[model samples]
Target: MITNGMIAPVNLTANVNNLNQLQNKATPAEAAESFASFLKNALDSVAAQEQNVHKVNDQFIIGEANVNDVMIASSKAELSLALTSQVRNKVIEAYQEIMRTQL
Candidate 1:
């Protein structure tokens, strides 16, 4: 029963209402805290992985671990650290870009 232009008006109104509701939900401070918590968790995970690698290396040194096991653990820890550094670099770059944007 509706024309295409009429449907477009209804869709636009619904989208605007949804966007308003989403904008009202969270303050900037809350969002910043959530992001900080996420970063802390990521750092904790990386540290845990490094600790596991150290344990594997210690065991290998004492002749209590298999060579292949130590090698795999070391590689995994190296990759995790490398990936974490890359993510950090990307985040910093994004922040810099945002700062440079004209308001």
Candidate 2:
């Protein structure tokens, strides 16, 4: 199972079962709400990482944090932002593709 702050092997069978349950139970409105909340949470996480980078850099300047910590924080923030940008691009592309469908 996916839990906080640790890496472990995922049970794909369990995950697929849970996903099937969600698909069966959720209405379109519920799905939309879920998607919106997910996007908001992801953006919030990205913002938090960016803020952490700044905080780490400040601490490093005062010799409280090490260069390694600062570098890692910066890298995490950069990667999160890049991932968010890519997701946005993919979502836009999917929407455009749907719009272009001749149905």
Candidate 3:
């Protein structure tokens, strides 16, 4: 359930399914792997969204779609990419700070 207060929920079912899948894992290794998988899945989702924007833009140029659809897709893609970038930056910062620890 990621929200930025700008876009309406597009796929609640996908988020619910992801949460359900994560709940079934109990072991430490399973949890770690599930977390990694979750991040990968999120990245894949944003990539798909960016691809959708490109598709919509192309369709608009071809007279098959309109500006509104393209704008919506583009905004969604932009927000998702920004969110992904922030998460990645935070992860890297945490790793670096951990490396600086004494022991």
Which candidate number has the best TM-score?
A: 3
Overall local distance difference test of candidate 2: 0.69
Local error of candidate 1 at residue 93 (angstroms): 1.2
Q: Which has the greatest lDDT?
A: 3
Query: Of 1 and 2, which scores higher on lDDT?
Result: 2
Of 1 and 3, the candidate ahead on TM-score is 3
Q: On a 0 to 100 scale, what is the lDDT of residue 57 in model 3?
A: 85
lDDT of 2 by residue, 5-101 (tens): 2112223374345445556655888766655665676677777778777877888898887877777778777877898899889999999999999
TM-score of 3: 0.78
Which residue runs of candidate 1 sit more than 4 Å off their true CA positions?
1-25
lDDT of 3 by residue, 23-84 (tens): 78878788778777777778788988887888888888999877777788898889888988
Q: List the lowest-lDDT window of 10 residues for candidate 3.
A: 3-12
